[model samples]
Target: MNIASRPTAATPPPNALITEAVQLIEEAGPLDDAAAMREAMARRTDLPGRIALRAQLLGQRLGLQHELARARQWAPWIGLGLVLAIVLAGLGLAGSVVGGAERRINIMAALVSLLGLHLLTLLAWLLGLLLPLRAPRLSFGWLWMTLTARVAGGRQGQAPVLMRAATRLLARARLLPWALGLVSHGIWTLSFLVVLAALLFALAFHRYTLNWETTILDPQFFLQAVQWLGRLPAVFGFATPDAGVVLAPGGMADAAGQRSWALWLTGCIVVYGLLPRMLLLLLSVAMWQWRRRGLQPALDAPCHRRLAARFEALAPRAIVDADPGAEHPPAPARPLDTGDALLAVGFELPPDVAWPPAGLPADARALRIDGSAEARRTLLDTAAQLRPRALLLACRAAASPDRGTERLLRELLAHCGDCGLWLLAEDGGAALPETGVQRWRDWLRDCGLERIAVHARLGDALAGG
Candidate 1:
């Protein structure tokens, strides 16, 4: 199905399937037991009653994972607020140190300290992405999750696990990292804006001269760099001092020159530092939203596949033999002295196997039992009512004999005495696993059934009977 057409977390109904699934997960405690989860979903009549049960369930799971993450980090905004405060305080402190000095502030040094550090951070982030594996410590989001996990321990601690599992399930979606990058860069962008605001405020009230002093690098190089930086903002009609004025720098010659230098510095910070960060933030957000729109769980995963099968099995259908062999002709019906003599039943039969083999008496009845509570109850009730003289229970060899099978057998045996148990193996039993056959034998033996028959083919079993 096209996941993009489906409702997302951004736009959902009041009683969304995902919200319901999150409640179920919370009530489930540890989120184990796939059967119980399926049962819970099956019981919900409010859910969209449709053929896409698997897709709906998966979408709900995604929603539940998101809810868990949000709950675990209950106050993420608090962390963001703290970060903003720290940025403002740091910028304010730097501004104080710059404006407090009697000597002129080195505009080049201030720009490098502010914008260069951010550029280096951006480069580090890019390099980390290129590496196949990254340390957890390198991830700002991971650190945030870790800190929040510690605060909300135990049951709440499952958020990280859920998040990791969701990421793996939706790895092809590629939304998580982009979403995280958007937030990280957004914070940086905001920080720069706050720093710019502080710088502007300092420039307005305090009279500070702008100078450039570097021993190793020639002044010409610094002048050229400033001129280059000013060019972008100059396009927007901001003042870009001439090469002569930039090169003649010890300190600004006059108040007008100092004002012009301030404008140039402000323009450079806005153009170089703020604008690039803002663009990256917007790009990350766009990518994140695009990926989120297409996010879908891996429906082919074993757990989801089994759940889908379970849902499909709930649909009622006629009990008919799926596989019939052409090798054996129908045996002539042998009249039985007793009425309602033999009833053949197949339990969780594979699609390839036939039911009620041709060799059975013409009067013999056939039934197929699926893996459902209602089906099991119906089978038991039908057996009690019919009370066939001899019963034949057939099961596929590929199906592992579980406690549910044993329970059904016990119940059936209680209703019909002296029943014949048949294990129908695929491919004339040649491809049947020895261990699977032995396992069934062992289970039957434990149930005190001594005459269990293993048949490679339905025709052979019927002919033998």
Candidate 2:
């Protein structure tokens, strides 16, 4: 008889076979390959149910593969868009300068052009620094680039792939506060010089207007000129009555002939010159406030709350509920002896918490390899190195236990013992060893590891000095 036409059982069907397959894998039980298969098949005696289950699993796999491919395609484009934006902004700034100088492109105009160029560069750098998080398009762009790299390897044409990879670097904005601050300080310092130049220009122009008799170089004249200039309207548009420091107007003049020219010049100078400086100072002050308030009890409470929310979304867990505010007992730290080679296993940790302590031993390195096939290969390669005191393993725990994590642990354990391996975990769960801890230890012993240390606390000697 054909399996598809097999008679149904007298008992009513309780659950779909696909659901049963997933449930069987999830519920903890003894490991017997043949028995497990028999149990799974027994859940759905009908051939059609078993066939439907297989089809469902196949479809899920296909969907995941398609997502990976789409992510790959998007990654490089994101990176390119960022880099292009930088180049375009630079060019646009140059265009604005050329466009500003309608006819009499004198020394003063040249200086103004230089100042505009400098501001444009600063703007580009800030945009680049904040790109990762601030630029909405970058995340998918990075995802695509990474996927492309995984598929194409070194064989993928270098330009498009590499460019996207470069753009994706914009997303890591945490480092921006310091790096951008240093650059900003430099830019603002240069800006101070620019403002001083503008002030001096205003003073000289005033001196020339009020007293053509007195020498332009006279210090007394310069002082008086500046004093009068400062008294003028803080807001742009009202021109000095006697001063000949006219900024030529462009476009159709609406407020009569000469009046429109004065207003336009004042508007341009205020916007392009004074406004940028004011904005820079404000941003610098705000950055200072954020850093200062970071330590305050009021600020710390809110920041901690925000941080907890972020952690919950990234890696959901029940165990991550420990008070960030409350001081806990420090974990014991043990330094590893230096060897010829060290294997770093793990993913990069978020910046708020410290890892790798002060100084990791030269012979010992660790990588945060979570649930990834590439991560597994990375672990196995280090094991193959076969040097004494070779392998170091570490994991940042999720806030909660889930099926995906449990599968990762199983895979990690299956290939762990080759050289000395150190497994570190933030908290015990699927990311840590669940079963066969002794078996793994035995394998390590056989591979010449003197001793294997296990600890639950994150702030331990194994992490660093």
Candidate 3:
């Protein structure tokens, strides 16, 4: 059973991996870019928080929320409609066994009619899970999604992103089978139950005789088929017709024989049809819940990554100061109660770029940033706690600047008394391409950090050169 509709895909990526406890990423509406800039610079949340909120706002601004809400509202109805249709289909199959004018039930024909379609669909569902398969859009679950999409104004704006993100998310978590199977089995379970009810009603209320009919098969074959099909049902306490009833000519059976045949058919439907479908429905529910506990969006998707980068430009401190100051912002004399004399953090750097850049002071604390939410949070927390005298944020010179980087710069700058951007390269790093240096210079200026030194080497940055 669905406890709720789908949760947000852009929840704050976990400190380690995504977990259910993560809060819903807030959806936002249109706002002035300037206002967003001021808000971001003043904001205290981490990178993931900022990105999630910004992406949500951007989506709403583009009118995704209305469409998304409509889709979600219709999701359950589509699912329920499929279930209702299954029940009607099964009832129709059961009714096919009832003779309009004759007073006999063709036992074999009735059995095939009730179970044939169910078995075929069940087999197809199994094959889908066994192979390296994506859940087809035509399947009941996806049909619901598609129909709901149409009801919600079709796949426009961020709607497609949500759809692709959901597939990628569930498929990556290996829950596609469990999810699709849940719906599949639910449909079959209800259908089989309906068929069973109809068969019981006809059996109890009508006086029709029950017997097998075959044009080419031997009497021995009918005897064997009944015995084989009835073994398991008999084990479950169902009455099975004996050879006297099965081998009789013209499919004629006495009252007792007819009774036996009736129970046998009911037992077959219950044991093979209803029981298996219900059990599978339960299993799919359990597996889906188990596999999907901590499910989060796979960030590798270009759409989700793009949403995250949407606010890369409007950092909280991307706000500029009214008056200019000296080129170098002076360092704090020292930490008041406690903190590193110098805190050097390595932002996403290549493996070749040496970590904890050499020549840190005795009281310096060195940390490496691997680009995970946890790593970023740890650095931010440490900086806030230590109140470091100087923060030397070392980034690679070759790395292209993005809004995320600028936001990170602003947040890091806010925590420490003095903060500077250090462009790491081997010797003669500062003398590299003029374009690269100037680009970074522009990036820093845009972050309102122009006065902060952009050092080319460890020594020069430390020495205030």
**Local lDDT at 240 for model 2:** 38
Indicate the TM-score of model 1. Answer: 0.56
Question: What C-alpha lDDT values do all the predictions have?
Answer: 0.58, 0.38, 0.65
Please give each candidate's TM-score: 0.56, 0.26, 0.62
lDDT of 2: 0.38
Q: Is candidate 1 or candidate 2 better by lDDT?
A: 1
**Which wins on TM-score, candidate 1 or candidate 2?**
1
Model 1 off-target regions past 4 Å?
Answer: 1-38, 44-73, 93-97, 126-143, 154-156, 306-465
lDDT tens digits by residue: candidate 2, 36-138: 3343344643333433333234324333324334445654564455445534553443334333434222223433554555556556655655664343222
**Candidate 1's residue-wise lDDT over 114-198, tens digit each?**
7776677676666655564442244444455455544443464445544454444334465555655665677778788788888
**Looking at candidate 3, what is the lDDT of residue 187?**
80
lDDT of model 2, residue 48: 37
Q: Measure candidate 3: CA RMSD.
A: 10.8
Q: What's the lDDT for residue 142 in model 2?
A: 32
Q: Which prediction has the highest lDDT against the true structure? A: 3
